[model samples]
Target: MITFILRRLATGVAMLVTISITAFVLLNLGATDTARRLVGQTASAEIVARKAAELGLDRPLGERFFEWITAALTGDLGRSWQSGQSVVDAIATRLPVTLSLTIGAVIVSAALAIALGALAAGRRGWTDRVVQVLSVIGGAIPGFLIALILVLVFAISLRWFPATGYVRPEDSLGGWLATIALPVIALSIGAIGSVAQQVRGSMIDALRHDYVRTLRARGLPHHRVVYRHVLRNAAGPALSTLGLQFIVMFGGAVIVEQVFSLPGIGQSAVAATVVGDVPFVMGIVIVTAILVVIVNLAVDLLQGWLNPKVRLS
Candidate 1:
């Protein structure tokens, strides 16, 4: 298990390094003159050139990347070129909002997926058809549209939740949950559909397996045979799908944050990218990549726990 964990961590580190370098190169290589943007467009050419030089846009890419990575390793991501705020500090402030939405969505989606998927698999009639239809509808709709509908219905019409903004869980727990509820539901629809489909398929296959039959023949109760044996076996694939959904939600969160005015890493990334805040954008990339790595590692650990053979492999 230790070896497996070490190997995954090493892979994650390599991935983070690769992503950081790529983001830096791409941001710098773009034609959108970061210096000119930093200065007013009406600024003289000479002034723009001087600004570029000051910002090290004149430096070789390799040299700049080396300096940036070294500083990053030492926990200095540099201040935003636009706002002059420490990149790390800016991200730290907003990370919790994104995490709350994403983690909440994941938890909701998983619970819904298990119940819907198991029902579809076990019942296998009109109930199965209904679940399949709902899954299809859920998967077909875009998340931003879902967010809009939720805001319109729950926030505007019913006034059950706030239409925009966020509240810290520490500040007011009820306010926090109410603020995040719509966003979480909007984010979860597609994930629940995808994961539930995977679960239903995996469960059906597991139910048909020889071991399931043997357990049943050995006088095991139907619920025990299904829940303890079949569901556990089916969960491995569903978990992988759910992990992928978690990553997808980050992208969706960008649009959702804009619609709902939630301050999060997604919103920060958008703001930074618009002004070509290279250091801040790079910080967002690194932090998001690190999160993806951590989630992937968690999924791997869960899979290993569920099936010991995964650790051996």
Candidate 2:
């Protein structure tokens, strides 16, 4: 198990390095000059050149990439070209809101998926059909559309919660939760469908195995047979799929944040992109890549723990 974990961690680090390189190259490939975009259009050519030089953009591409990576490792993510503020500070300020929303969405989605999936698998009749229909509807609708509808119904008409913006949890936990409730629900809807589908499929497949049949023939209670034997065996693949779904949810939250006017990393990334704030954009990309690598590693470890056969091998 230790050896497997170490190998997977090494691979994850390599993958993150590749992601960083790709993000850096793509961000710098655009026509807009970062210095000019930051300094303003009316600035003289000489001034722009001097600013670019000061920022080390005038150096060779290899040197610039090396500098960026070195600075990142040392905890200096560079200054935002637009605001002249440290990119790290900006990210720190916005991290709480994004984390709050992401965590809430994941919790809601995971609980609902597991419950609905197990229920559908055990029932396997009209209840299963109903769940399937709901899952399809959930998968078909876009998150932004769901957010809009939720705002119209719950915020505008019902006036139950604020329609936009975020409040720090420290100020008022209730208000913070209320403001994010709609957005989290919107983000979770699609995730629930995907996770439930995977869980149900895995459960059904596990139930058909010879070991499950033997347990049933041995006069085990139906609940114990389904939950203890079948579901336990099925959990390995479901958990792996859940981790991948979480990564997808994080990426999709960007659009959901924009539509809902939530102040999150997604909104910051979009703002940076529009204004060509290279450092800020790259910072977000690097953070996202790191998160993906870490999540994948964690999932691999979890799979090994859940399935001893994998660990032993």
Candidate 3:
């Protein structure tokens, strides 16, 4: 297990390095006159040169990357060109806001999907048909559209959840939950559909296996036979898909944050990119890549643990 973790860590590092390099290259390639752009199109030559020196844009690519990596390793993500704040600090401040939405969405999506999927697989009448039809429709709808509908209904009409802005959990747990509930639902509605479909397919396949028949023949209760025997076997794939969906949720949060007027890494990232804030953009990219890699690694390790055959191979 230690070896496995070490290996995964190495892979994660390599992936991070690649991401950083790509971001750095793209940034440099587009911003050839970095200092000129930083100041303004009308800035004098001396001012441009001075800003260039301050930014170290004149340095060789290798040295710049080394310094950038060194700073990143120390969590000093440089200053945002746009806001003039420490990029790392900016992202850190917003991280929890985005995390709250993403984590809440994950919980809701997984629970809703698993219940619907399992029921659809186990039952053969209206319950099955309804789950199937809803999954299709839900998957077809964009998350932003879903979010708007939710805002219109829950926030504007019913006035159950806050229309915009995030409430700090420390201030009021109830308010925070209510504030986040709609966004979470909006973020997860599509995920619920996709995951449910995967689960339904996997469960149906698992039910046909000889082990399921053996469990049923032994007179195990219907729920146990389906949930314990079938669901467990099916979960490996479903969980893998869920991991990918978590990453998708992170990306989708950017657009959703805009619609809801929530201050988060997603919102910050967009502003940074729009203004050519290389340091901030690079910071966001590296953080996001690390998260994606870590989640995928966890899924791999989990699958190995759940299935001995996977570990063996």
Candidate 4:
């Protein structure tokens, strides 16, 4: 297990390095003038040239990429060409918001998935049929649509929470949770659908295995057989699917953040890319890549732990 984990860590590092190179190649090799576009078209030619020089855009691509990667490793993600704010600091400021939204969505999705999935797996008749139908419909609808509907029903029609705006937890726990609640629900809807389907399928398969009957014949309590045996068997694939849902939610959070006027890494990335803020854009890209790689690694470790027969090394 330790060996497998070390290998995964190495793989994650390699993936991050590749992603950094790809992002840099896109930035410096693209036709856009990074400095001028970031500074604005109205800036004088002299100002553009000076800005480019100051930003090290005047250097060769190889040199610039090296410097950029070095600084990134050292926790200096460069200054935003527009705001002059450190890219790392800016992202750090927004990281909590994004994390909170994603975490909330994960919790909600996981709970819904486990419950609906187990129910559907455990029975036949209308309950199973209803869960299957709902899963299909929910999966067919995109997350942004869910966000719109939620805002309309819960925020606009009922006014249960603010339509827009975010609050820091440090200020008011209730306010902060209330602000993020709708966005979390919006992000989780599609995820719950996908995960529930996966769980239902996996659970059904696990329940049918010969060992399940053997356990049942041994007088094991139904709940014990389901929880101790069935869930552990089903969880490996469900966990992997859950990790993928996390990635999807990150993308969805970009639009949802904008819709709700919440400051988050996704929104920051969009703004940076729109303005050709190369450093900030690259910073966001690197961070996102790292996050994905770490998630995959974590999933592998978790699955391995769940089943002793599963071997990675």
- Runs off by more than 4 Å, candidate 1: none
lDDT (tens digit, per residue) of candidate 4 on 152-185: 9999999999989999999999999999999999
Q: Estimate each model's TM-score.
A: 0.97, 0.94, 0.95, 0.95
lDDT per residue (tens digit) for residues 1-313 in model 2? 7799888888888887898888888877742377787778888998889878877677777778898999999999999988899999999888777767777888899899988888899899999998889999998998889988999999999999888888788998898889899989988998898888888999999888899889989999988988787887788877777787778778888988888788889988887888788899888888877777777877777778778887776
RMSD of 4: 1.6
Of 1 and 2, the candidate ahead on TM-score is 1
User: Lowest lDDT 10-mer window, candidate 2?
Assistant: 26-35
- Local distance difference test scores for all models: 0.92, 0.84, 0.87, 0.87
User: Best by lDDT, which number?
Assistant: 1
Worst lDDT run of 10 residues, candidate 4, spans 29-38
* Cα-lDDT of candidate 4: 0.87
User: How would you encode candidate 3's per-residue C-alpha lDDT over 1-313 as one tens digit per residue?
Assistant: 6666677789988988888898899987655476676788898988988887787787888898899889889879899987799887898899888889998999999999999999999997999999999999998899999999999998999988889988889999998898888889989998999999999999999898998889888999999998877898898989988999999999999989888988888888877776578898998898899888889888878987777666555
Off by over 4 Å in 4: 43-46
* Model 3 TM-score, 2 decimals: 0.95
